[model samples]
Target: MTEILGLYNYWIVIFLMMTGFYIVIARENLIKTIIGLNIFQTSVFLLYITMGKVTHGTAPILKASHGGESHGVEHGVEHGAEHGHELHAAAEGHVDLGVDAVKEVYSNPIPSVLMLTAIVVGIATTALALALVVRIREEYGTIEEDEILEMDRNS
Candidate 1:
């Protein structure tokens, strides 16, 4: 039950995705189809953002030392020592290069950045689609797919 509850965001994403898909497939109106596409896009964005989250995580920001001497290494070493651990090299057989192991857990920023780009692209695509729909309405006096098909058949 706890495991299922923890995946609430995934459930929401699936629901929105199916709803959007149904709207696009079952509706005949051009406007409704565009709205459905937008819904689908939103669900994808939500999924990416949700996947990028980490438990008890923070933004990946490195704090610089006020003085030019220590360079934050002392702080890392002190933190590790406080936790009853020693900072070690990341790999075996490699010399300890004095690099501090950052114990902070940080959420990945890539998914959010990619989603932002996708949102801009989605908005541009939707605008183009709506403009095309308007032109279709002007030409056929209707935006219904069935009506448009009937007109095409009669012509």
Candidate 2:
């Protein structure tokens, strides 16, 4: 029961993904297609947000605390590197905080930040696509895929 509960979000994500995929593939109207694209984008955003979440973690904000220290060495670090010391190697793009070193478990913020940027871009792209659709509708008198193709072939 607990395991299933934990995975409810995943199930929701899958449902959204499938719904969006179906819309994009099965629709004929240009506006509908754009809506489908938006749905698909929404699912992607949700997926990224979900993946970034930590089971018992908080936000990835650094807080000042004078609490007790931790102990343990992390893997994938240099041989001479000390335990509980994370590397700030941007080239490698990975850091290992030793076991229990970070008292407050913070969820990875990278995905959330990236998703924010993507959301902005997606909004702009969606707006542009809708504008193009409006123009297409005005010129062709219809937004259906078949009608647009007929118009093109007629021209």
Best by lDDT: 1
lDDT of 2 at 74: 24
Q: TM-score, each model? A: 0.71, 0.68
Model 2: colliding residue pairs? none
Q: Model 2: per-residue lDDT, tens digit, 32-54? A: 88899899998999999999999
Candidate 2's error at 83, in angstroms? Answer: 25
lDDT of 1 by residue, 27-126 (tens): 8799999999999888889899889989998764543432332444466566656665354521221223223323456788899899999999999989
Indicate the TM-score of model 1: 0.71
The model with the greatest TM-score is 1
**How high is the CA lDDT of each candidate model?**
0.78, 0.77
Question: What ranges in model 1 sit over 4 Å off?
Answer: 59-104
